[model samples]
Target: MQQSIMSTLPLLLLLLFSSLFPAPSHAWGIHGHLIVCQIAQGRLSDAAAAAVRGLLPSYAGGNLSSLCSWADGVKLRYPWSAPLHYIDTPDHLCSYTYDRDCKDEDSFRGRCVAGAINNYTSQLLTYDATSPSTQYNLTQALLFLAHFVGDIHQPLHVGFTSDKGGNTIDVHWYTRKTVLHHVWDDNIIKTAENDYYGEGVAEFVDALMQNITGEWSQRVPGWEECSKNQTTCPDTYASESIAAACDWAYKDVTEDSLLEDAYFGSRLPVVNLRLAQGGVRLAATLNRIFS
Candidate 1:
């Protein structure tokens, strides 16, 4: 009887844990849509197969029906959010320290780091590649690559030192309980939904891609500079935080209340430009590898 009860404790704890944060419906199939769209744009021969590889079970089992189905009504219309899976744990978020070391004592942190690196590498490859044989894989990979690239750019993804990436900072978002990470992930972009979903999102991401060309070209050197310039890191991180604060405030107040607009508007051009540059570079990478 004692043994049985002890065994049941683990099961009970699992059940309780599961209930605390129910898996969101929108979470799974997002990566598939981003991948499919990019591949379709490239028109790769094996685009269909590659796009479906990491799709959610629902999408893979034919419940979703189409790749575009995944994007029908996602949060914030930030397509990049799909491929960049959310790290629910605070430990995971804070693991991305300046030194590339993860203090988290779990496999999730390792997986997250590897996933991020792989995503980055894939984009670099796709941007440089042009060969037909490798183009298909590169093209398909580019979509996933692009989406993931955007995810890393989100300051919250890197996280703060003490707050565990905003998870610990609990606050109310329009009278509803929310945290800093959620605000960054959904709120800031949500405020821009009207503008972001339409031509605005495309334009914003495009401009960013252009501005980051030189920095991205020498991504290694860029990070080295970033390390030396630690002060810039906090400031850059604060910019994102302030944008998030203004976004949460927007829902209640007039549009003018959203000060993030000025910053977002000013910064969007650079974002879009960098994305375009990354995409092109990603293609170039694939060409070189297979050529």
Candidate 2:
């Protein structure tokens, strides 16, 4: 009995320490959201640029990318915003129908990520810098749209209902005890930025922009599908993520899965496309709103 108590003491202490310290809560990881925001900033129209300049001076220097992670930073104070990060679908069905899914009990009249995107977007359309309340709403709305766009693109954010979007399924990247969601959220992007684009974040963003060739860089007009009365459009984006999550993110994944080069190599293109689409679509949304 003494030996048993002694054996468990270390684990008890470890649990206490871990609970006190706690790992950082990352949404789309910092650099992931930054990359998407940077791309959108690069693609913003002149009107959109002017609007961003006026609304976001509270950031480090009015840089649009500065506010990209604002929603994550505030998630603690506003617990309600947490569900804005992901949309859940039923297990193994491998498809998204927003009407059937996307609604959670905690949601405000069934507001999920897609619904949040649409709701906030309409607020941006009537942005008023003069009124303090309007200014505050505008800031929050912009932050939500920026973060949600990146979030929805992450395949796992539109993931299975069973695993809390892969958060419950344990896995590891090399030696780190993480889960499948973190692999999609941080590991892959971290690997790409650190290993492939070793020149640091700014350089990496520049390279990513320069690498955007073929149809990836092409601008699409009227690309804000969530504008006005339309709800199905954002669902389409969620559907794309759900499909990718089922077909790719869940492939061969298990609790003991060890992620490495092969995993990153196969999924890098998907990551890039998601980022590109997110950036372009974000620019499209801003263009329409601030036009």
Q: Who wins the TM-score comparison?
A: 2
Cα-lDDT of candidate 1: 0.37
Alpha carbon RMSD to native, model 1: 13.1
Question: For residues 1-291, could you state the per-residue lDDT of candidate 2 as single tens digits?
Answer: 574355445434544553555435546887888988998998888888888776653333556676676677665556787777888888999998867887875545446888888878877878764544423357667778988988888899888888988989988787788889988888888888888778377776776677664454454433445545452257778888988988788888888888777777888888877777777677777877887
- Model 2: ten consecutive residues of lowest lDDT: 215-224
**For residues 120-171, what per-residue lDDT tens digits would candidate 1 score against the true structure?**
4544334331232233333334333434333443444444435544556665
Task: Write down the TM-score for model 1.
Answer: 0.39
Off by over 4 Å in 1: 1-104, 107-110, 114-116, 119-147, 173-177, 195-291
Best by lDDT: 2
Clashes of each: 42, 0
Residue 201: error of model 1 in Å? 5.3
| lDDT values for all models | 0.37, 0.75
Per-prediction CA RMSD (Å): 13.1, 10.8
